[model samples]
Target chain A: MDQFIKINSLKKVFGEGEDEVHAFGPVDISIKSGEFVSVLGPSGCGKSTLMLMMAGLLEPTSGEIYFDDKSVSGPKNDIGIMFQDNTLVPWRTVEGNIKLQLELRNLDISKYKDKIFNILKSVKLEDFAKRYPSELSGGMQQRAAFCQAMIHEPNTILLDEPLGKLDAMTREKIRSDIQNLWMINKPTVIFVTHSIEEAVQLSSRVILISPRPGIVDREINIDLPYPRDLSVKRSNKFFEYVHEIQEVFHEYGVI
Target chain B: MASSKNKLSGFLKWIASGWMLILFFVLFFLFWEYSIPLFDVPRYILPAPTEIVQKGSADIDKLIYYTGVTGLETIIGYAIAIILGLGFGIAISFSSILRRTLYPFFVSIEMTPKIAFAPLFISWFGFGLLPKVIIVVLVCFFPIVLNAILAFNSLSNELTLFHRSTGANPLKTFFKIRLPAAMPQCFVGFKYAAINATVGATIAEFIGSDQGLGFYISIVTGNMRPDLAFAGIFFLTLLGLSLFGFVTLMEKILIPWHISMKRINK
Candidate 1:
């Protein structure tokens, strides 16, 4: 597997001198091309900080990140990010929000209209193309946000607990939708989440980070087959994987 | 049939919500009309509402002309303030140095009695429409600039990061993300500015101008025609309401996606 993203001992510290706070790192991570990796940890563990550094949204206090052999300096066009909150501009309609990806890239909207419409249709938001974020349900908004992030068809996608605030049913549905999307697109994804089950379900590998000044404590391979559904979650195999990840947390005394 | 019944119910609901306000105004005005005579109050002290209405109707054309002048001053001043406010706001937001240098200056100006500037404006511009417009701009400019600063700074880190990650240039990010996200707050500033614009114009006219409702009121009151002064006041109220309503209507049209606007639309 080609290393699409390589993080070399990245560290982030806030403030200076006496007031300094260690955010995360001296952490190293490498993600393969077309791989889905989840960073799971306890709250305030700087999992999100790690993800941000990977996305080039946050500057590492010290260290380097490489994307496809090129050092990541700043936000790259080929990277997509979705935050925990669906940060859809409130004033834009569903279609408009999706179109923002194309607009930002200065891509021809007329050429991509069909592509956008198709994405909306696939997400079951075709009827809500004209509706605003405020008019949509939490799940629908998250779906719209997912569409927004994926619209430009970035090679690498970084998600910061995108489904953390959603209800269980909605979360499961979006998680599955994400899986189906990943299966189709095969983009390298670095998803940050606190949910062990979510990490187990979605990622090809799970990177567990220890609480605060977070370090990559463990990496667990899901070894699950593709096209996973709710039934797989019920199976003993899924529980075993979940249990295995939970035990890593138990070792850290985090759970 | 169902549609018509729904319309009827909607109308009934509207009336139900508004009846108290209507009743309060009516009873209050009736008391004013009767109490003036009962208490033997002179006309110049407190004219009856009927007397004021009669005086207003008699001078309707003159009143309308003054109303138009004041309205124009308010609208034009507000428009200028909107442009300048947004410009200054963006400038301040774009650079921390400028924000630090200019924020206190703006705060001091805002804190200073706006009326204190009235005489200086009249002296510089000489009691013309220009002075009144300047006053309106001065009065209305602060809220817009302040609110715009608030709006621009209020851009969420996630949204900015999303924009940046998509390769949006700073200019594109500002226009597409910052401006749109800040619109609801911008409208709030606009609403306050609109109302203040009217007050600004009227205050300028009260100090110096001779061709607005403010001037007309001064003249009528000096002439001991309290009824006509009351009529001028009535027109002023209308001007305030009209400007406020116009801004609110624009808000609805522009930011129907805003939660408050969305709820209203629903």
Candidate 2:
């Protein structure tokens, strides 16, 4: 796979003059297609900001992002994004919410009916397709959100802590579910999270961002085998990868 | 078979939930019936419920006619307000120019007592259907518009981001995501406007109209027939409740997925 996304010297400054706050940085990173890259950082470290800019939802104060050699000026339909909040349209059912992406992309909804079911089934939400977001548990709602993000089958997926709101058990469950879904499609995913274990477990490469005015602190390649489940999580190899990232945060006084 | 049984149980539970309120009203009415005579309260001052019911039944045709007139005015004015309020609200949400110019103007109009305009409307439009409808419009329009503005503006930041990421056009976003997301709050406006609709029509009638429950109440009260006046008031209450009920029904139909409605269903 070729270089799918490139962020060069990107910086974001909020407000102006006297009140200016340097939110993110002159950070540089390149993600190849089909690579699961996690942007690990502490709170207020602009990980979410970085993801937003990459998705072309937020314009950086300076620098540019290239997607497949094309300069990203505005929001691109070729990439899927999920935020911490499930953001499911409460009025729509789980299936209807996923269908919404297809509807927005002007794709024929009838064609993706099978895909919708399959995605829902992968997230264990097959029975919940007809249920409203409010009726679902917090984890279930996030799973539905995951389905929505995957429905378009975009080449790139930007996930900004999509499982941030779920409890420990549910987050672990959904995390694996997300991996399973991502494996099936093999979309290049930029997963932004504060968790060292999460970053190490899910991504092929982990990009650690430091505190405010965030810059790439370290890039650790996780050469772990496929299906980084409980066994992989318990392995000495995974612990070593997690400890390495933790040491970076430790240096930043984040932990 | 289990589903049918569940349905039966659900029906029974619904009835059980409602009966206590009905029973309270029944008891209260009984107490009022006996206490009025015990207190030696003059019939003209406050007619007993029984007397009001008797007088109301006897004058049912006239009462129904006036009720219909007021109901018509309320419905028309309320419907027009719904369309105009929602239109302006959506427009204001889309355009900063409209928000700056029209929004403050609407706020100022809303701040002033709408009932005060009843006499002015009657003088301008005369003692006819027009004046009453105008008053109803003034009363109902502001709440709907205000709530609508709040509703449309209340789309969550995450949802807005999701919408942007999809590259959904403004028109599609408004209909598919923004509109549906704004609905629960919009229903808040709708229900409030429904409550105000009757008040607007009745107050306008009080100032000028020759027809309607409001006019009937004024005339009967002046003629020292409190029973008949109360009967007119009784019809007005029914009209207000039914109008409110209609909006609530729409809310249930449109947003059954809403948390408020979900709690009710549970």
Candidate 3:
């Protein structure tokens, strides 16, 4: 079986000896080809920095990341990274924006046009294919960003607080949509957010990372059934896990 | 039906706004008619509105001919400035190394006065349309380039990243994202370029050209026909204003999103 992604003893230090700041690492994590794992922790806990290292945007001070048996270095064609800020080029239309992945690889655009349209329509921005990013509302822009991420069909997607900018209602709508997109595509995904409830709701497994110079505090496999609803929050099992994780943070004075 | 009513009301409001401008003009003419005469001003020094109008209409055919010649030069010069300035600006902005090396050079050149260079342009380009167009291009280039850079450089980085992550090719990104993003600023550049370029053309014409309002003024002024000189000067101002208005129209059409002109018209 393809071990979709593996992180081994990763470490990242920002400065020299005494002034050194350690951002998430000297830890190991792994995900199977189709697993959805969410890393949850308090702010300053280094979950996002860890994701950045894994996504190839930031280099690790030491350690290795393997994608489908291949050692990862910098950005790879098989991976896609999304963040709170959607960097849409100002000059292109919605369709042009989505096809950027294919364009970057110098791939045939004709083949991807229909798929891009489908994604745009699904996001309710089919009518906006010709509109610039500046013309969009924040929610619409984020939806378009999501469409762009999905356009290339990358096997691994790393999201860094993508839904953090939206209002609660829009956030919930997009959150479910992202989870659905992951399930349908079965992309090995690493969703990094500081929200424990969000991690519980979205992840197949929740991994809590400790504060800067981060180490894995705990990893728990969620046994909840599929198409899970927020109503599941009322369940004793859900509260137990949330409380168990909360206690871990409480011990660290991070809750 | 409801929209039609709204439009009608809008038109009425527009007509009402016209009154204030009309009042200003009326007051200005009255001052021209009475104030100078009351102060016993000399005709060579200050002509009344009626006298200027009489001078303008005295040789209607000559004024019309001269207006056409100068108008043609101004329009041509202005067009050249807009097209060439925009091209040069975009080219420089596209290359970071070029921008870094040439930007300071262009700024220094922009600050150097073209009026002092008039005799040199006359000697170099001769008494023809070339010198005038060159002057216009020089006058217009700086603003368009500055505004283009400001517009192009100021795009939201987050939006740019979104496009890259999606894999948009550089050319597509420039057209879809960069160009539209720079539009409003481009219009601002155009407005300044259009007006200043007209003045440049007139000055260049005054220094050496055989035909144009500036040439006519040079001859008319020496002849002590102050009324005619004043009439020509007024028309020159009018021509510049017309060009400015045209650039403004283009701006409204190009970047309707700009705040300045949004409430005015379609």
Candidate 4:
């Protein structure tokens, strides 16, 4: 498998001298194309900072990030991002908000009409195309946000705990929603999350990080079949993976 | 049939929404109208509602003309303030240097008593419409500009990161994301400026002016014509209310999806 994304000794420090804070890193990660990877850690673990650097949205204090063998020094267009809060523009309807991606990239909207429709239908938000973000429920808003992130079908997606704000039921349902969606394009994904069960349930591999100024402590492969769901989660293998990750967190005194 | 029913319901809703305030004012007016003779109060001191209406109608032409003059000043001044305020807001939002420096300078200016500048403006710009408009702009500009600055800068870090990830050019981000996101807040400034616009215009007229409801009220009160003064006050109240209403209407038209609109509509 070709390494689609390579992070080499990336580090971030917030200030200088007395006020300086080590945010994250001196860490390395290699993700193959179409691989689903989760960077999981406890609160203040700097997982988000690492994700931000990889997406080229933040300047790393040192080291480098390479996407498809090219150095990513700044924001790159071939990436989609989702955050904990669904930041849909309130003035726009769900459809309009989704179309913003196309408009910003100067893509031909007419050509993508059917594609947009299909994505919205896949998320069961087709009936809510005309509703504004403020009008939608928390779950629906996040679903719409998911559609927005996937609309462009970018080569890689970086999600910063996109389901963090949701209730347990909604979180479980969207966990499978994300799996189904990732299968459609098979884009490389680096998901930043705190939930061990969530990381095990979705990503093919989970990269565990130690608490603050986070560094990679371990990487465990799920080696599970595709279309993972509740039934799959009920399996003994799933429980083992979850237990294994829980033990690491417990060892680090993070749980 | 359905259309008529909808219209009837709409009318009923409108009445239902307004009847309480209308009823309260009606009772208040009737009490005032009847209380004058019952209390044997002097007409000049506390004129009956009937006397104010009679006096007001007798000078209807003058009242309307001055109301128009004040209204024009308020609207023009408010419009200019909106333009300048929003422009400054957008500018500061883009540049950190401006946000750090210009923002504090503007805040200091807002902190000073704005009405104190009314006489200074009259001396500099003279008694023409220019001075009054200047006062109105001064009064209306700060709230709008302040709120706009807050609005434009208030975007969340997550959203900013999302914008950056899109690789959107700065201009595209401003227009497509920043500007639209700023509207609900900018309208907050706009509505506040609307209320202040009338006060600014009236203060300017009060300090020194040949025409306007403010000047009219001042002159009539000086002549001991309380009834006519009350009439002028009535016209001024109408001007203020209508200006405020116009702003609210624009807010509804522009951002019907705003939380403020949703609350009010509910």
Candidate 5:
């Protein structure tokens, strides 16, 4: 597969000198187009910082990031992102929130209204376009966040634990929702999660990092097929790989 | 769909308005209307309800005329207040040093009593509408400007980060996001100052002017016509309430998504 996005020797330092904490570092990563990759690690693992650096929201202390063979110095329009908190403006109606992408572009929105409506329908939020974010359930709000991020049809999606805030049932459901959405959109999605099961279920390529100034400890490629569901976890084939991933974690002293 | 919902809401609001507060107004009116009669009081001592109504009807043309003067002053004063308030609010919020440098002086000015300054104003402005308008601006600007600052502060860091990540420049961020976020705050200032501006204008009229509702009240009370004074008082109250309601209406129209409007009636 051709290099769609490449990160070369990325490093991030929080402060200068003695007060400084070395955060992320010297890591190389390349993601192929339309690949579903998950970066899994424990808390304070600097995985999030790496994602931010990749999205051009953060400047690495050193090294380079390139998207489609061009150096990414800052945030570009072609990148989509979803955070843990669904940052929908409470004052805006659901349609207003969805149209924020069009609004930002200063372009005429009449061309994209149908596309936005289709996304709302796909997210099952069509009946809720007139309502505010506060009126929706936690799960629904996250779905709206997802729709807004992917609406612009960006090449890459950085999901920073978008389902982390939800309850178990809602988390599991949104996990499927996101997987299916990615299937349709086919964006190069780099999902960051603490949950190994979640990473296994969704990612075709899982990059596990060691704690504190995280470097890639393991890169496991899952041969799992598409349309994965909760029952897939119960299959013997799934456990075989889960054991292997667990062994990688053990080797990294993360178990 | 909206109108019927509003009507239903209006009816519910009217019922809710009576939810233990209107009884106080009823009691106040009843006591004023009946207490004087029971005590065999003269009009100077206290005006009866019928007498107040009679006095009001007897001087309808004159009362309306003076109401116009006070009402006009109030309106002009309020408009000037809003313009200045919004301008000052935006300015102060955008600049940190300006806020700190001017805050003390602004607070002192807001604190100084209008009644004490009225005679000086009258001496300078000579019973015209300018003095009243100035007072209105003084009273209204502080709350509105302060409210604007409050609105600016209420934006979450997470939300700001989201917009900043989208490659939106500062101007785009301010106009599209921060401005709308501060709008509800602007409405708060609008609501507060609308009523307060009228009060400021009235206070100015009371001490200085020779021809306003304040002047009308003085003449009626001096002539031992407290009922007519009561009528004038009621007119003033209605005017204040109407002005307040107008600001609230603007707020609802501008920001229907505000949490206050979305609240379901109990």
Candidate 6:
């Protein structure tokens, strides 16, 4: 497998002087093309900081990140991101939010209208194309946000705890939707989450990090089959993967 | 039948919301009209509502002309203030050095009573409409600049990050993200500026002007026509309310998606 992204001895330190705080790293990671990887850890473990750095949204205090052999100094057009909060503009409707992707790239809207609508339809939000963010339910808003991220059909996607605040049922539904979308598009994905089950279920490999001066403590390969669903989650093999990750957390005194 | 029922309910809702305000004013006026004579208070001390209305009707044409003049000055001055405030607010937000140097200067100007500058404006622009308009601009500009600064600065980092990650340029991020986010706060500044616009124009007229509701009031009160003075005040209140209502209407049109506006619609 070709290495699509490479992180070398990355580090981040926030503030200056007496108030200086160490956020993460002196760590390294490399992801193969079309691989689904999850960085799983406890809250405030700096998983989000790592994701932001990879997306080129934050400047690293040291080290470097490379995408497709090119050093990333700033945000790139080939990367799409979904934040933990939906962050949908309240003033924009569902369609407008998705269209933001095209607008930002200065793409021809007439050519992409059908493509935009198809993604909305796939997310079951076609009927709500005119509704504002305030009018939609939490799940619907999340779906709209997902569609916005996918509309550009980028080569890579970064998801920062996208389903963290959702209810159990909504989380499961969206999780499956994500799996289906990944299977179809096969974009290189970096998912951040605190839930052990979620990381194990979605990712082919999970990078576990410890909190407070966050660092990669362990890496576990799930070796799960493709086109995963809720049924796969119920298998004994899934339970073993979940248990293995839990034991690492126990080692770090996280649970 | 359904449409008719809907219309009926809408009418009932309108009346239900407004009846108390109407009743309160009617009862207060009645009490004022009856109590003044009962107490044997002199006309100059506190003229009856009826006397004020009669005087107002007698000078209706002149009152309307003066009200029109004041209203025009307020609107023109407010329009100029909005342009300047929004321009300066955006410019300062874009540069940290500008914000650090200019913000304190703006706050100092805002702190000084705008009324104190009335005579200086009169000296520069003379006793015509120019001084009144300048005063209105000075009074109304600060709220817009302050509110706009707050709005621009308070946009969530997550939102900006989302836009940046999408590879949006600074100009696109500004129009699609920053400007829309700043609107609610901008409207707050607009409301304050709208109200202050009236006070500024009136103060300027009072300092020195040949026409306007303020000048008319000064003349009436100086001539001992207390009832006419009350009439001028009534016209001024109308001017203030009309301008305020116009700002609210613009707010509804511009940002119906805002939470406050959405709640009101609901």
Relative to the true structure, how large is the alpha-carbon lDDT of every model? Answer: 0.88, 0.90, 0.79, 0.90, 0.83, 0.90
For B149-217, candidate 6 gives per-residue lDDT tens digits of: 999999887788888877778988898889999999999999999989989998888889999999999
Q: Which of 3 and 6 is ahead in lDDT?
A: 6
State how far residue B89 of model 3 sits from its true place (Å): 3.6
Task: Rank candidates by TM-score, best first.
Answer: 4, 2, 6, 1, 5, 3
Instruction: Identify the superior model by DockQ, candidate 1 or candidate 5.
Output: 1
- Residue-level lDDT of model 2, residues B2-116, one tens digit each, is 9999999998988898899989999999999999999999998988998999988999999999989999999999999999999999999888999999999999998899899
Clash pairs detected, candidate 6:
none
For residue B185, give model 5's deviation from the true position in Å: 1.8
How would you encode candidate 5's per-residue C-alpha lDDT over A35-106 as one tens digit per residue?
Answer: 999999887889889988887778899999988889988776677888888778877878888788667756
List the candidate 5 regions with Cα displacement exceeding 4 Å.
A14-27, A42-46, A209-217, A237-255, B1-24, B37-45, B95-119, B168-175, B218-225, B264-266
**Candidate 5 docking: what grade?**
acceptable
How far residue A197's Cα lies from its native spot in candidate 5, in Å, is 2.5
- Model 2, which residues run further than 4 Å from truth? B1-12
Off by over 4 Å in 1: B1-13
Q: Which ten contiguous residues of candidate 1 chain A have the minimum total lDDT?
A: A72-81
True contacts kept of 6: 0.81
What's the CA RMSD for each of the models? 2.2, 1.8, 4.3, 1.5, 3.7, 1.7
Per-candidate interface DockQ score:
0.76, 0.83, 0.27, 0.79, 0.43, 0.75
* Highest TM-score against the true fold, candidate: 4
TM-score for predicted model 4 compared with the true structure:
0.97
- lDDT string for model 2 (A148-214, tens) is 9888888889899988877999888888998898889799999999888888889999998989989
Residue A88, model 2: lDDT of 90
Off by over 4 Å in 3: A9-27, A41-62, A88-136, A209-220, A244-255, B1-13, B16-43, B64-91, B94-96, B163-180, B218-226, B245-266
